[model samples]
Target: MTLASRPAVVILSQASHALGRKIANAIDGDLHGASARTSEVDFAFDEAKAHLSYLFSTGRPIVAVMASGALIRILAPLLTDKFFEPAVVAVSDDGASVVPLLGGHRGGNDLARKIAAVLDGHAAVTTAGDLRFGVALDQPPRGYVLANPENAKAVMAELVAGASARLIGQASWLSNTRIPFAADGTVTLTVTDRPRTAAPLELVYHPKTLVLGMGCERHASTEEAIELARTALADSGLARESLSCVASIDVKADETAIHAVAGHFGVPARFFSAARLEEEAPRLKNPSDIVFAEVGCHGVAEGAALAGASPSGDLVFPKIKSKGATAAIACGPAPVDPDTVGRARGKLFVVGIGPGADQWRSPEVSTMVAASTDLVGYSLYLDLLGTLADGKIRHDFDLGKEEARVVHAMELAGEGKSVALVCSGDAGIYAMATLVFELFDKGGISDAASRIEVQVSPGISALQAAAARIGAPLGHDFCTISLSDLLTPWEHIQRRVKAAGEGDFVIAFYNPVSMKRRTQLAYARDKLLEYRPATTPVILATNLGRLGEHVRTVPLGELNVDDVDMLTVVVVGSSESRTVVTGDGKSWVYTPRGYSGKSDTGMSKEVSQ
Candidate 1:
C-alpha cells in the first residue's frame, strides 16, 4: 500500500502483463515498466504477506490497482486505516478504462484521470465534494482536529452549495480551508487554543481568543509590558500565540510591544481609530489619566471584539494592580454562535502537590497548574506556587474547607475559563477532586458546568511521600487508616487497624496523632504488637519535603510518642521492609528484592534495621 497523490485512474486489467509497464511508470514519474512483481496470483494471501504496506503509511496518497475480485477483497480490508488504502480504480486489460472505485482523496481518483489522459479515455470520478468545492479547511490533510465530526458532512455539503463561508478559530492554522459558511453574528468557538484572525462572518474553532489593548508610557520597557502581558496570559493558562493580533491606535506603530507581540505570535498588528478608542475607553482595565491624554483608547481590541460578539460579552479587568501600575483588558465567554456551541469545551483541573514541597509535586500536576487560568485553594497551597501564582486569579479561603473553592473554580470554568482547584498531596487522597465528582454526581453542577470539561490530574499522596522519605514500608499489601475520626467513626478505625494487624499487612497511618486525637496511634501500635515482633522498624517522616522537615527511622520498641504529629506520616514496616547501609556507609531503606525476579540478591546479604 504505497500511498501517493490521489490516483489518476484505477486500471482493472485482467492481468498485470498488459498494463504493468505503463502503470509503474506513471506512479513514480520514473518508469518501473512491466518488470515489477507478476507471480502474485493464484496463492493463499496468508502465504503472500509481501506487499510494501510501509510505503503507503507515509501519508502520501496512493493509486491502488485491483486486478480481480480477490484483489479487491484483500485490498478492501487493507484500505480501512487510510494508510494502505489509496485511490483504487479498475481498467480492463484491453486498455479500456472502466470502474473507478474508492478514494478520491487518496491518489486513486487523480490517478484514474492521469491514466485516462494517457490512454486517451475518460476517467471515472464519482465524488461531488471534490468536483464542487475543490478543497475545504476542515479537510486539513494531517493536523485538523475538528471539534464536531458529526456536523462536518453537513458543513461540507453547505460549502459545496457555494454559500459565503469563513473560518474563525485556531483552525486558521490550516493551509487549505475552503468552507462556504458565514458567521451571522453567531460565533462557534473553542477556548482551548489561539484563534486565527477572522472577520465578523466566519465560522471559527479558536477556543482561546482574546483582545488585549495596552496604553503605556512612551517607550515603555518591552520587558515590563511583555512580562505583564505574559503574566495575564499565563495566569489564564491560555497560549499567547492565540492572540489574533495586537490591535492598537495608529499613533503607537513604533511601540516595541505591539510589534514584539505580533512578531511573537507571527501575526499582523491591526490599528483602530482613535475616535473608536475614545468610545471604548470605558471598558479598559483602568480608568487611566495617561491613556486619555495620550492614546485615548479605553480598550482597543478588547472592547471592539466584545461589542462585536453575538451576545456582546461583558468587559472586565480580570487583572488588578496596586496603584496606576501595569494594565490589561479581558473579554468574553462571549456567547458562541449556535454553530460553535461544542467547538471546544472548557477544562477544570484539580492538582495535588504532595505534602508541602516541589520534590513531591508530580510533573503532570505541575503542568496543569501552569496551564490554569485561576487557582483556588487554601491560602498556603496557592502561596506554595510563588512566582507561578503571580498572574492567575487567586481565591484563597480558610483551611479545612475546600468544597466552596472547588465549586467556585468549576463555576469559572463553566464560563469558558480554565480553572485549577489546588489540593494538598494526591487530589484523590482525601482531596477535593473526588468531592467534585461526587458533587457533580449528585447534580450539584449546572447546565453550563455540565457542558464544561472536568478532569483530575493526580499527584503523589502525603502517605506515599512519607513512606518514600522513610522506607518502602508499603512495598507489599498495606492499608491506610486515618485516626482523626472526623469523617469516620473511631470504632471503624479500630476495626480496620485490628484487621490489618490480624492480616499481617503493613500499615501507613495518616492523621495519626493530632492534638485532640492522641490515643489512636498508641492503640494501633499496641494492636500491631500482638501480631508480630515489637522490634519492627517504625519510620517517622515529619513535615516531609517542607521547611524544617525531619526524618527518623527507629525500631518499634524505640518509637517516641512525642515526635509523632498530625503532620507526620507513620510507616510501621512489614516483615520484609528493611534498613540497609550502602558500601559508602549511607544509610537507606528498601524492601527486600526477593520478588524482583533476581534470585541472586539474597535478603541476608544486606544490613537490616
Candidate 2:
C-alpha cells in the first residue's frame, strides 16, 4: 500500500460539490465530481464507489465527501493492514463533520485535522493511543523509521496503563510528543542507527545521518564494492540502513559498482567535481599524488566523504581499501543531504513530449521534464511544452539545427545542470536520440559529455497514436519507414517500402510528403498496391493527439498526394486487414490476429475502395 503523493477528493452528491471543492482547494488536491456545476474539477464520475476505488488503487490518499457509513461500506472490501494502507477520510456534504475512518495514525488523522480546519469543523479522530497521548508510536514523525512495529501495540498499552518507559539517544521529535518517558523505566526506546534486536518491550528508530564515501576501479564488480563498504560499516559498528547517500568523485559518477552499492543500501549516489574534492584534500588521511595526476584530486574516498560532511563534520573512519575499491564514513552534525554539498554528475534526458498533449505524455517523460534544470529543442517543440517548461533555462534552436541543439544540451549537462532535450514524438524514432549516440560514435562526444549520464524517455510516437485513433490498423505485424531523403538515400527508402509491402506487414509512413518533396507518397502507394488490394484500408492520421486532430480511412488506390503532408502519418493495412462500421455508424479498422480461424467470432466486414 503506497500513499499517493497527490491527494484526491471524491464527491458522491450534488450537495457535497461545494464542500469537495473547498477541501480540494485547501489541500491542493484533485476533484472527481458528482455534478457538472464546477468546471474546475479534475474529473466527474457517475459511480461513486468505483471512482473512489480507482483513486484508492492509484495510491492516493482519498477524502470522500459523503456519509461516513457509506464510505466505510464501500472501502471495507479493500481494507488491508493499517501499516501500509493509505489515509482514507470521510467529510460530511455540508462540511460540518470530518471523520478519519481508516489509517488514522498513518495519515488520515493529519488529513482530517487539515480538512477540519479548512471547513471550520471538528475532527473526529478515534485512534485510542493518540487520544491517551499526543503521539502515535508506530508513526514516529518523518526522518525516523520505526523498527519492530509489531511491538508498538504492547508498549502503547503498557504506557496507557501507567507503565514507565526509558528514552535513549537524542530524540528531539519526542520533545513536544508527550510519549510518557521515564529515565529509569523498563521499556527501553532506543533512537540510534545500530543493528540491534528489539526486546518485546522496546522500540528502535533509525535516523538517516550517515554518508558513505566510495571510490572504485573502472568496471569493478558490484559484489566487491558491497563487501568492502559493508565491512567498513561493520567494523565501525554503523547500521548500513542509516546511510543517506553514497558520495564519490564525478569521474566515478558512472561507476556501476558504486551505484550498485547505493542501490543495495537504498540510498542515492551523489558525485562531486575534482575541484570540489581537492578542496577537502587537507582533511584527507591518505592524500595521493598519483590520484591528483589522474583525476586532478589528491584523494577520492576520504576527500569525497569530507566534501559531503557538514562544516564541522570529520571523517569518522579513514579510507579503507579492498582489491578494487575504497570506502570511508563521515559523521555530520545534521542529517546529510548529498544534493546540497556536491555538484551532481551532469545528466541529459532525451525526452519525447508526445504530440503536444498532456494526457498522451508518459509519466517518465513528465518526471524527466520536471527534473530538468534546462530545456533544449526546436522552438516549436519547446513552445508545445507550454507551462511544463516554466522556471527552466530555455535554449531553443531552429528546425534544422539538430546537431547544435543536442551538443548544447550535452554541454549544459556536462556543466552539472540537468538538461532535457525535448523531442516531438518518440526520441528513438527518427529523433534526436540517434543523433546523440551518433555524435558519441563520431568522436564529437566531449569528455564532459562522455562523463554525463544520458537517459532516453519514450513518448507516444506518431505511428502509435495514429494506429490507436484509427482502431488498431496495426494489429498485425508492422513496420515504420521514414521517406525523408535529406539524410537517407531515396533508393533505400524505396527498398524498405517495397520489402514491407511484399512481407504483408502494415506500414506506417513518416515524412510521407513535404512542400518540396511530392512524389514519394504516390510512388510508395503504387508499390504497396501490388501486394495489397486496391481497397486496402489506408489510415491518414494528422496532428495525432493534438488539437485539430483528423483521422480518415481511405483505400490504397484512392490515396491523394495532395491531401498528405509531413504532419500526417499514413498507415497502409496488410492483406488481411478489414474495415467495419459499428452500431453507432463509426468506422473501425483492424487487422485479423488469426484467432478468427479457430473461434466463431464475427470480427470481419467488407471494405470499400
Candidate 3:
C-alpha cells in the first residue's frame, strides 16, 4: 500500500479555511475543504463523512478544522483499532483551541501541539500518560518502532498511576524528551532494533538500522530481485521491517528492479556514487575484478551495503545471488540512527511565508527555513525574511526569474543539501509551487529535483488576508482571478471574469492594476458590473498582513482605478454579501453562510464584550 507523504487539514467554513491553511502550512500538509463551503485549497470533498472516511483509510494524520461534536459524529463509525488508527485532531475555526480527538499517543497530541504553536493557541491534550509524565510509550521518534503496541495501554496506565518504569537500552534521545523513567521499576522497556523476545510485562521496540544492498542485471525481473532479497532476509533470520533503506551504486539509480525490491519492502532506495562505493572495497566479503570493470566498484551489493551502514556496522549476509540479481545485508550497530549512517538524501521545501509579515508566518515555515542549508527566492523577498536568512546560502534572483530560482534550489537539493524555495502568500496559489512541479516535469536539470523529497507548505494567501482584514466577504462561494496578462492571455482572463460574474462568485482580483497593464482590471470591473449591483460592497486591501497596510470598502460603481496598485487585492462582493455599520461606525462586509438558525454551526464570528 502506498502511504501519503503528508498530513491533511480539513476545513468547512471561511473562518476555519484560513486557520486550516495555517495549520497545513505549519505541518507541511495538504489543505482540504468541504464542497459546501467556498474553499480555495489544495483538495475539496463533496461530503465531510466521505472525505474523512477516505483520509482514515490512507493511514496518514488528519487535522479537521471544525467543532469537536461534528468531528466526533463523522468519525464515530470509522473508529476501529487504536494501534493502527491514524492521528485525528479537531481545531476550532477561530484558531482558539486544538483538541486531540484520536491517536493521542500515535501522533494526534503532537500534531495538535504543533498547530497550537503556529496559531498561538493551546492544545487540549487529554491523554493520561501525556498529561502526567509527558511520555507516550507507544509513539517513539523516527528509527524506533514499538514491538507490542497492544501492551502500551496497560503500561501507560501504570505509569500514569505513579508506577515507576525502567529503560533497558541506550536511548540518549529519550533523555532530552523528558520521558518518565526510573532506574528500577515493575515495568521494563527494551529498546533494540535487532530480533529479540519480550520479557513478561516488558515492551520491546525495534529501530530501523539494517541496510539492504542490492544489484541486478539491466533487464532483471522485479519478482526475481524482490524474492531473492526476501529469501536472503529469511535465511539470516532478520525481520524485513527493521530494514531502513536499500543501498546501491549511482549507476543503477534508475534501475527498475532495484526500486521495485525497495518498494516491496517499504523502504527508500538510496544511491551512492561509484567513488563512494569504491571506498567500501576493503569491507566487501566477495570482491570481484569483473564487477570493478563493469561498475567501477569491487562489489556493488556488498560495497554499497557497507557504505550506507554505520562505521561500526558489519555485513550480516554476503553476496546472496539469484539468476540475474544479487543481495547483501549489513547490520548497523545497536541504537542505529538512520540519519547518521546513510548518505543524506536531498529534500526541497517549497514554503510560503504569508504576505511579508513575521507574525503571519507559520511556525513550520520558520522551522523549515531554519533547517534548510540553502534558500532561493526573489531578492526582495529574501531580504524581507531579515535575520532569519542569516548564515544560510541565499540564491536570490529578480522578480521574474522564477524558473532560475527553482532550478538553483533543485540543484542544491540534488547535491544532498536541504533547500527551501520561498514564496509570498500561498505557494500553491499562483506561486512557485506550480513552477517547481512544472520544472520537475520538464526533466533535464529537474531530474534531481524529481527524485529528491518535495513538500509544499501552505500560507495565508493575499485573498484570505484581505478577507480577514475586511470582514468575511468570502463567506460564500468565491473564486480568485489574476488580471495580469503577462503569462496568461487576456482572452482567458476575460472568459474567467465573465464566468465568475455569471456564477455570482465573490471575486478577488490579484494583480488588478500594474503600471504597464491597466486595461485588464478596468475590463474586469465592467464585466462584474453587468451581473452585480452598483451598491455591491467592494474591498480594496493593500499590503495585507504587512507594514503600511491599508483596507477600505467602496461601492462597485465608485471604485477608483488609481486607488489600486499591483500590491493591492480587490475583493468584489457577491449579490449575497451584506454590509453592517458596526459600533465603531465602520462598514464591515460579510456574506451569511445561511447557518443562522442552526445552533453550534455557523461561520465563527468575532465576539465583542
Candidate 4:
C-alpha cells in the first residue's frame, strides 16, 4: 500500500495533541483533532472512528495518537485489502510506543520507525520478515518494483528457515540486509531493468532506470500519444514498470496528450523548459532543426528523455514519430527522481469555503486547499480556513478587489504553483469562478496564464444555508439575485426583481444592503409584495454558519432596509409558501410542492373506486 501525498496524524484529546504535532511535523502530515475535545488542529472531525475510517478509505496514511486497541477496533471492519489500504500506525498518547498495526510491509512500518525516532520511543515492528532480515522482500524501497509479489512469501519463508540465496543482479540495499548470499544457492534474487519473469524460487525486481520522453502537437489525441509511447517501450524491449516518469518540454505541460501518456504508464508527468531541453542538444541522437525552430529545442523527445534521466544517461531509443506525436526512451545509471528534473503543470483551484464553518466546507475544497502551494483570497475568507491555511503563501486582498485576487491567483498558478482562490459561499454563484472564465474568454492574459489549468470546487452557498436554517423555504422553485448595483445597472436589477416577483418564484437576495446602498432591498421588498402576499414569510439569515448566527422571519410588508445588512441573505417566500408557528413559539417556513393537489387527486380516485 503506497501512501498518498500527505499523511494524517489524528489526536482525540488535547493531552495527545502535543505528541501528535511532533509526529506530524516530522512527517509533514496534517494534524486532525476531534472537534469537541481538541483545538488548534489542521482539521477537525466530529467523531474519531468515522474520521479514521474516512482517512483509511481515501488511502491516506494515518498515525492515530491513541490506544492501539481502540484504533484497531475503529479500522478493523475496513481491513479488507492490505495491498491497497494505506498505512495505519498507532502511537501511545504519551508518545512512548509506536506500533505498525497494518500495512507494515507497505508503509506502516516505515512510518512507525520515523515517528518512533522523532518521539524517542520504540517502534514495535512485528512483521516477521522485517524483524528477521531488516527488509520486507515483498515491498522493496523506492525505484524498485517487485515483479511478482505472489512469489515473495515462499522466498521469504525459505530465507527465514536458514536457506542461503544467490544474488543474480545489483541491489545495494539487499546487500546491506541480513540475507545470507552464496555463490551457489537454491533460492535466487534477481534485480534488473530489463523485462524478465521470475522462476518459482526466484524473486524479480525491476529498477526504475528508464524515462519515457514524449512530445505532441497541440490538441493531439490522447490515444495517439499513448500508443506511440507503448510502441517505443515495446520495440526497445523495455518493461513499462521500469519507467520513472514521462517527460516533455514545459510548453506542453498542460497538453492533454502528454498527461495521458504519463497516466497510461502510472508515472508522474515532468516537464523541462525549452532552454533546459536545448542544453541537451549535444546528447540528442535525433536533433531536428525544425523542432528547434518550433519550440526552441532541437529534440523535445530525446532531449527531455536525457535531461530527465540524468546527465550521463543515454537514449536507448531515439525519437520515434507518429502522425502528431513523438516518443523516446532513455536509460539512467540509477532511478530518476521526476521532481528533481522540471516543474509540474500549473493549476488554479477556484474554491468556495461556505459560510465560515469547518463542517460546512466540502471535503473536496479541503483537499484542494491542502494541496495548494499558495492561498489567494479576501483576508476574512482565508482566516475561515483556520489551521488549513498554515504554512501556505497567502496573498490577501481587500474586499471589492475580486478581479485583482483572481488575476493574482492565475498568475501564481501560471508560474507552476498550485494556487487556491478562496471565496465565501459557492464559487460559481456570484464568485470568482465567473471572473476566472471571463478573463480566459477575453484573452488578455499572458501565455502561461492562458495555458494554466483551472478547476472550480463548489461549496455550500448562502442561499442554501439560509433556506436550511429557516426550515425549507427553498423547497419550491427559487432564484438568487444580487442587489449590489455597483457592477450591474440598477435598471437590470429592478427588472430581475420585478420578473421574479411576476413569476412568483421564491427569491434569495445576496448583497442585500451595504453601507451606501440600502434602498435596493426596500425596492425588492416593495416589488415582491406586489406579487406575493403582504403576510408572506421573509427569512433574514445573518452569518449563516458562523458565530453570532441569526435567523429570523418577518412579513414581506414589514421587511425594511434597517433590518438587513451586507452579511445577511434575504429569502422571500412565494405566494404558495407558508409559515408554521410551533408550540415552542419558533417559526418555520416552507413552500408546499403541490402535495395537496396530489392528495386530493388520490382521494377522488379512491371515492370513484
C-alpha TM-scores of all predictions: 0.45, 0.79, 0.58, 0.93
Best lDDT among the predictions, by candidate number: 4
Residue lDDT tens for model 4, 109-178: 9999999998899999998899989899988999999988888889989988899999988989898998
Give lDDT: candidate 3, residue 133: 65
Against the reference, the lDDT scores of all candidates come to 0.57, 0.83, 0.81, 0.89
Q: What's the best-to-worst order under lDDT?
A: 4, 2, 3, 1
Off by over 4 Å in 1: 1-345, 593-609
Please give the lDDT score for candidate 3: 0.81
Task: Write one digit per residue (lDDT tens) for candidate 3, span 1-609.
Answer: 112536878887766766777787688676777766744555656788888888887787889888889888888888889988889998887888999999898889999999999999999998876776667778977777788887887777776677777887776655554556788887888876557777666778777778899988997999999999999889888877688889887657557898898889877788787888888888889999999999888998998788777668899889989999999998877535545544445778899988967667775786577668789999877876765676679898998887778888887887767888999998899899997778777775744456676888888899999999878998989999988888999899999999999999999998898888888877888888999998999999988876789999999988889889889999999988999999989878998867775555333542221
Ranking by TM-score: 4, 2, 3, 1
Using TM-score as the measure, the top candidate is 4
lDDT of 2 by residue, 464-486 (tens): 99888878887779999998899
The 10-residue segment with the lowest total lDDT in model 4: 1-10
RMSD, every candidate, angstroms: 21.2, 5.4, 11.5, 3.2
